[model samples]
Target chain A: MHTLDVALGERSYPIHIGRGLLDDPAPILARLKTPRVALVTNDRVGPLYLERVQHGLERAGVRCTAVVLPDGEAHKDWPTLNLVFDALLGARCERSTTLIALGGGVVGDMAGFAAATYQRGMPFMQMPTTLLSQVDSSVGGKTAINHPLGKNMIGAFYQPRLVIADTATLDTLPDRELKAGVAEVIKYGLIRDAAFFAWLEDNLERILARDPDVLAQAIERSCRNKAEVVAADETERGERALLNLGHTFGHAIETGLGYGEWLHGEAVAAGTVMAARLSRDLGWLGEGDLDRLVALFERAGLPVQGPKLGAERYLELMAHDKKVEDGRLRLVLLDGIGASRVSDAAAPERIAAAIEACCA
Target chain B: MHTLDVALGERSYPIHIGRGLLDDPAPILARLKTPRVALVTNDRVGPLYLERVQHGLERAGVRCTAVVLPDGEAHKDWPTLNLVFDALLGARCERSTTLIALGGGVVGDMAGFAAATYQRGMPFMQMPTTLLSQVDSSVGGKTAINHPLGKNMIGAFYQPRLVIADTATLDTLPDRELKAGVAEVIKYGLIRDAAFFAWLEDNLERILARDPDVLAQAIERSCRNKAEVVAADETERGERALLNLGHTFGHAIETGLGYGEWLHGEAVAAGTVMAARLSRDLGWLGEGDLDRLVALFERAGLPVQGPKLGAERYLELMAHDKKVEDGRLRLVLLDGIGASRVSDAAAPERIAAAIEACCA
Candidate 1:
């Protein structure tokens, strides 16, 4: 097992990465001093792993209530978030009551956000059940639900009390979902660690196959990198924006395609490839680098191309993305495989050309 | 002007309390390194004060785009919040854009929450136009919109970069609204400062009359008290909960009555009276203490009795209040005129009697 701490002082929490950790609730529930808890999950994840978490919490002598929300990215909005509050209220949960988010990115984000606002903030534990959540969403403390105007338009940088990432959960994730999680794992390497990227290049298949050891290592490294970035920039003021390497483009795709159609990780995968291509076109990277990114994404069985939304619609969708500023589209482009920078000065024509190339 | 710093490190901001501070934008706009801003106000406050703030910001070389939302607590929900976002996006506001919230608690909370979430948070100034906002809501960064299920069900604690409380704006406020603000001012005295409570008792009429110096001092003292508590417990872990002294009860009143029918301060005014009475019944407070609280609320022309929602219904309403935890009702009872404690052990019979006492 590997551990990383997101240092937010009193809000600080640990990300524990390993296989079979889900069955062990000591680390996650130990921090919750409350006697009662409400485990928030979704229909998809609840039937699979809810019992394991509920049993772990129950064994700890904590009374638990499980709320199963409908599963999907489209459901990650105000209405669904309200359901969380309704369930908590129905259970008569209070300020001291802890909320356990036991699912993928959508569930974690919504549950964490509900915790963040419930009674003006409550302690929550993140037991991420999806590969995507383990590596990215569950670590950063960025909890939010999407708004019709934009994704994650309403949220907070509220840290959880603990994050328990049991690699075994990934064993049941669909192949596409597994590939999606790998996209974020690949992101850490593409943005900050060439060595890790090389490791990913060598172990992509093992990760896809849910090899416990390799998956645990990858989740740990990804969390460590994310934890450091979040600790330094808890609110994504500057350096943290580097973590959104493919997100600006990815958000455009997600929104343009009507959010749930393409999995966030899949869109991010295609977006990363596009970002690398744009970097190459803008003379920031070599063609070989773009090819390497494309090959890695393909090897992970993730998409390397976005929907055929024209440049104008893409621009409109990108404008609504959380990344754009003052209507000047800011793209997080790779300076190389191991570093990234957010730039609004990237020529629109070049970006449009890259989008065209990716779609074509 | 008396200034109090919220001490949230980078998120720390100053609350400037005095007469005519709105005319002086130098200190408030100083934090805005950018040249553009978007001022969010509402119909009631727009024609009265938005232009003055716009002039102040423009004179300070900050281009301003003003968005006027409908006035009322009922309007402080998602649709109204979206208006502010749309105006900013239409104006091509950047992440560095600073939002100036120039209205009462509704506008301040909604705009602050918008700033907190827009582009993953941005700097905003609170130009509180109502007495309630100036004293309480504007000082702490607890911004939110009412969910259909409850008031402030959706929001964040994103502090403002500057809180500009123009005592002058209160002059244009309706008598009832002005009285509502006093409820919060009285709250500070009840929970933490006996001396301030005594002063409020003596000067309630002058404040209601909009006496500039008296109002300024009242605003300054309330803000200072809130700032001290917030600095001690930024996330409401302990002392900060004291700030919600009347809020738990007040939230029930607002939610039970279907929000906006009674101004927030009016509900709080009545709720504080109920809390004081409850404390006395529980032997935590004396008769004189309850009378003093009731006297202060009456002097402010605020409600002393809750709506005639049956005791059973009030209990049902209180049960859903964010303060209730694990089916245990946590009441913030007054230790005296100026001290409070959050206790979940308060007997249900005593609480029921208090609610019954408040029934008309």
Candidate 2:
């Protein structure tokens, strides 16, 4: 087992990366000073692992209640988030009662958001069940639920008390979802770690096959990169924006494709390719690097081309993205793998050309 | 103007209390680096003072967009909150955009929560327009919305960049609402400020008349008391619980009666009386002090008795209150006005007796 701590003073928590960490509740439960707990999961994850988590928590002398929400991004809304509070209140959960999120990005985000707002805030542990959640969403303190107006429009920078990424759960994730997770994994490489990208290129098949060792290394590296970024820019005031490399364009795709139709990682996979092309046009990235990025995404069975949303519609949707500032589009562009910068000065023609090329 | 800072290190902000402060947004706006502003208010507050605040912000070169929500406590929910984000997003608000809440407790809490969640949080200024808000809700940074199951079931302790309580807004407030605001004003005295309590007893009438000088003193003292409590315990971890003197019982009343039926202050007024009576029975407070507390509540025209929810139902409702821990009832009992302790060991029979006495 490998542990990386996100140094946030009193808010600091360890990210445990291993094969069966979920079965061991001692460390996670030890961090929680309370005896009562509410386990938040989704239909896709509850039947598979919620019982085991409940058993572990109960054995540790903690009372437990489970709130199983419908599984999907479509269910990540206010009504769904309220179900968590309803379950907590019905069970008479107190502020000291901890929440354990036992699912993928949707569950983690919604459950974390529920914990953030449940009685102002409560300690929660992230037990991410999917690749995307295990590597990216689970490590960052960013918790949110999608608003009808925009994705992740309502949320808070609420960090978890602990993050337990059990590699065993990845066995149950569908192939498409696994590839989706790899999209985020690749994101870290393209934005801030060339060595990690090189490693991913070499071990892509091993990760695809759910090799525990390969998967563990990938998750650990992604979390380490994210933890470092989050520690320095806890609230995304500056350097944290680099983490949104393809998110500006990805959010537009997710919203335009009618969220949940395309997985977040899949949209991001395509968005990153578009962002790389934009970087090439801006002369910040070479054609060879862009080709390698596209090849990697293609090998992972992810899209390297944007959806057929025209430039005008793409601009409209991206305008609603949370990253936009004062009517100006802010794009996270690649200076080179392992480095990134956020800029709104990219000419409209360049952005349009990249959009057209990626869509075509 | 009297300026008292809520000393939370980097999160610290100044609370400016005085008459005619609303006309001067220079100090507050000067601290904010954003030139784009989103003004969040309600229909009632919009026509009354939104123009002046907007003019002030705009005159200072800050582009402002006003989002007017429905008026009253009933509107403090997800739907209304979504409107604020919609307006901000429609205006292309970035993470740097500042949100100015320009109404009462409802607007302040909703807007503050919106700011806390918008793009993981944006700078917000509390331009509290009502007495209840200026003294209590605005100063503490406890932002939330009532859930169908309970009051403040969802929220965060997101502090604002600045709090501008223009005492002049009180002139336009209704008499009932003015009395409601005094309930919180009376709270500071009951929790940990005996001298302040004595001052309220002496100047209750003057404060009701909206006496500029008296009102300013009252607001400043209330904020200073709250700021001190919050600084000592920002997350309501220890000493801060004392500030929730009547909140435990008050939340039960609000939840039992259905939010918006009784104004927050009215419910808190009755809750305070109940808490004092219970404190007296526990031998922590004298009968004379309880009578004095009840008299103050009555003079403010606030409810001194709770609704006819039976003892069993009250217990059930209070159990669901966020304050309850490990199935033990945690009540903030008064040792004396301005001195309180959170005790769960108080006898159930004594609590039942206090409830019976108050209801009778």
Model 2 residue A261 CA deviation in Å: 1.4
> Which candidate comes out best when scored by DockQ?
2
- What lDDT score is found at residue B135 in candidate 1? 88
Q: What are the TM-scores, per candidate, against the unseen true structure?
A: 0.94, 0.97
Q: Report model 2's TM-score to 2 decimal places.
A: 0.97
Report lDDT (Cα) of residue B85, candidate 2.
Answer: 80
Model 2, position B289: C-alpha lDDT score: 84
Number of backbone collisions per candidate, in order? 1, 3
TM-score between model 1 and native = 0.94
Model 2 per-residue lDDT tens digits across residues A1-360:
999999999889999888888889888767886788899999889999998989998998889999999999999998899888889888888888899999999999999999998999888889999999999999888889887667898888898999999999999999999999999999999989999999999999999999989999999999999999999989877889889888878888888888798899988988898899999889999988988999999999998888898988888877777667666788999888777889897877778889889985
Q: Is the docking of candidate 2 incorrect, acceptable, medium or high quality?
A: medium
For model 2, which pairs clash?
Answer: A192-A338, B192-B338, B193-B338
